[model samples]
Target chain A: MMLPGFPDAAPLAGLGGGILIGLAAALMLLGAGRIAGVSGIASRALGISDSGMSKSSAWMFIIGLPLGAFIVAVWSGGLDAKFAGTGALIAAGLLVGIGTRLGSGCTSGHGVCGVSRLSQRSVVATVTFMAAGIATVAIMNAMGLEVLQ
Target chain B: MIARYLPPLLSGTLFGGGLALGGMTNPARVRGFLDIFGNWDPTLAFVMGGAVIVMAIAWRIQARLAHPLFAPKFALPTRTDLTPKLIGGSALFGIGWGVAGLCPGPAVAALVIEPASAATFVAAMIAGMGIVRLIEKD
Candidate 1:
């Protein structure tokens, strides 16, 4: 089913995917007793951060991410993606890395896990990031910076 | 060892697959969702909503569990203070997310799908993280 005004929106697919993500996170929490936050996991895997999980275990999870995506891409024909120019990507990546570290989480950690549990910090962080993202996009659009191709 | 490692591997796979299937692997789609003022797409809201709903149930379940089935304990975050670092870092992350329409999860998931671009982003992101580490050391 399509959204009334947003013809491009795939609500069902989004919901299905969301459910799958939720299950993935649930598995992490219930099975391993961890929050499946990609940024934190990546840091731990790289030995940049300390965590209860082993480095090898962290690598396994990180590696599994692309493996799963590859499976879906293969089964679904292919995945389509677009990215900004190298300069923008580098700048953005830097900001993301630093910000997530300082903030202590990213979308998966704070947005999903934190928000679901009604954690005050996560809620505030989510709102702040959302607002910032919206504002950034708006400002970029105003300036005619066509980063998305 | 298998028991210790398998769960996270499975979790990551499911998470990555969900990201791909949810249309989040596509940067344009993510940017579209963020483009609230322009031609906005609400697909991400559904994804977030669905994930949050399921996770909310998981949290409820967590309250009753003595420990994680595979691990010794649940190592969740406990800090509650709202600090400048949190707000500033999140805001910076938001700007970056808006700039590229890619977050860590999708960026990592896209490693196989868009090798060159994803690699570039990931490499830069790692460097960004390194910068934070350096600054924190001072």
Candidate 2:
């Protein structure tokens, strides 16, 4: 199952990592008064021009996320990317920015938060957005769009 | 005995393993997948599908709980409007995923292995959230 994306492994790790985050977010919401929404916290901080306490906590959440895998890597090891080039990374970032903007939430928000709550709307958003994501990758692949060497 | 936190832990580990197995854990793999119309890696759907299967389980179990582990009930978003924020953010997310193959959770998680750029991706993502939150004005 994992072999499919042999060349890259981060997203595979990411999927596993994302589940933890989602579960944590769900538990955070269920156990605490928080919403488990990163944007909400970041947005609030951005509002005050202050990444304040919440901002720090949010960072901790994001930062600590990899700590698990980091711990795993400490004992074992991990793979690395050669980079298709700078242009490619930049373009990819821009595309994600657009998706986050359009999706009203990131994968975490919609995929985790929205979907967890069993929101019908979130259901549509997740399906639609994810489908679009698939399509985007397909198109990019078909175009033979390569990172400028 | 104290198995309450077990579910999250187990689920999380499985999720991580899924990522590692699917290659979603790697940024470059994501880029290649998104290099659509070119590389057009369809492996992503499998990753998403597998994760969604877990997601479905989470949803089902959610109903069984008398009360969620944290909140009185599931904390679904109150905002229902398909405001520009919704559509626009999604579009931006799609484009970024298509181009860079970096998404929020994984990008942050990717920080562990590929320290440099993953950090940058996360920073921009955080900044984007901050900026949007500010302009929305409550």
Candidate 3:
């Protein structure tokens, strides 16, 4: 069913997708004994930062990200995505990268994996980020400076 | 060596697929969820709920196992101290996410979905991280 005011939201798809994500994370934890924090992994892979995991393993997982997304996009007959302008994208990317590095995790690590495992730091980080995101959006909307179309 | 890498590869693949299917690859959808003040979208909530529930069970299973299947020890975060760095960084991340509706995972996954846009973002993100690394070297 549709949510109250969201005409284009897909709850079912979201849940199903989330299950897959959880399963994937579980596999990483049980099989490799690691939290599948994408930022940490990606940063390590790029040789930008070192979080202890071997660069080989990091690259392996990083490559798999696009591979899996490509498979899904092809199978689903293409996915729809709307990006912000180039300037906004660059600025946002820079902020996300710096912030996640300083915070030590992002949505995947802190939001999904951290919260589920009841990590106090992850919980706090997730709450803080979500609150910040909500406030940012609210403020942007008020200022009529919505970046995404 | 291959054995050590295979699990992560497979997991990453599934993670990417899930992100795509859950519409996390779509900035509009993610922004909709963040826009709680505007036309709020509850779909992303379901995504987070589903993932968290499953992972919660996974954590339970993990507690019983002495060691991981492929690794010698469970390599998990043990830091508990909450610092200004953590809070401040997260706030910056939230602002970025709010502005662009793009996070690390989705941004990387979108490399295939939208190569040019993803490339630009990834490049800038890497540079940002590099800047942090440089500053931290002090």
Candidate 4:
């Protein structure tokens, strides 16, 4: 449950949640024969990209994301989250949108699905983004930028 | 119709639920995980580890199947080349992820938890995707 020296860590919950996510992705892959990459699917749903999947299916998946979270929130009392300022959210959203398009995936696609398959591109992308993320956090900490409160 | 729609809907719902249970929906937890140098939280590593482990098993199963259960063929990515676009885009994405502690999936999943903020991020993300579409069209 709790990690030593890291009082805030919830290892068990993390692992449980992760297994659920993996099962979800596995369902998509096995049942639908799709990768379940959110960005690409979202783009397809929004008509920004013309991938192999149908728009209706994409929309269903997108809708299910919030619906599933809502169910979990209801069952587990509620959910708690902290967000950055409006400016930061917008900036980050834009960067994520563009970057995922260019890179062809995100944490779900590259980190989980791609890495599991041992794809070199996904591995490289995962490491690169992780390094960038860690570096960004370090720089932000050094600057004393309180993005999350 | 059921085969076409049900799988994604179910998968997305499970994905969302998993994110919430795993603490991926919490920006503080995500940022804490990313903040390895300053008060690091290892919760995300467990999440990633578990997901990857399960998926690795799924991949082995995939190698044996000629086609997905409901679909005629697997629509997986085939390109293996490492490109500048991939590295640059991922780095930019990482910066954004670090800045806000939200990615595409979690941002959508959090729509119910934090409606206003999540909506704003999703809208901006769509706009960003649109911008890329415009540039690529040229």
> Chain B TM-score of all predictions, in order?
0.98, 0.75, 0.96, 0.98
In the range A1-149, model 1's lDDT, one tens digit per residue, is 97999999999989998998999999999988888889999999998887657788789889988988999999999977888889999999999999999988899999999999999999999999999998999899999999865
lDDT of 4 at B94: 97
Candidate 2 structure quality by residue, lDDT tens digits, A18-91: 45455555455544434444444434334433422245444444444465556555545665543335555555
Model 4: docking quality category: high
Q: Tell me how many clashing residue pairs each candidate has.
A: 0, 76, 0, 0
| DockQ (0 to 1) for model 2 | 0.30
CAPRI band for model 1: high
- Put down candidate 3 lDDT per residue, B1-138, tens digits, no spaces: 679778889999999999999999888889889998778888889889999999999999999999999889998999999999999989999988988899999999999998988888888888878888899989
lDDT (Cα, 0-100) at A149 in candidate 2? 33
Fnat, model by model in order, equals: 0.86, 0.30, 0.84, 0.87
What is candidate 2's TM-score for chain A? 0.66
Q: How many steric overlaps does candidate 1 have?
A: 0
- Per DockQ, the best of the predicted structures is 4
**Candidate 2, CAPRI quality class derived from DockQ:** acceptable
The DockQ of each candidate is 0.88, 0.30, 0.85, 0.89
User: What does candidate 3's lDDT look like per residue over A1-149, in tens digits?
Assistant: 66665678898999999998999999989998988899889889988886657899888888988888999999999999998889989999999999999998899999999999889899999999999999988898899995764
Candidate 1 lDDT over B62-119, as tens digits, reads: 9999999988888888989999999999999999999999999999999999988899
The candidate that achieves the highest lDDT relative to the unseen native structure: 4
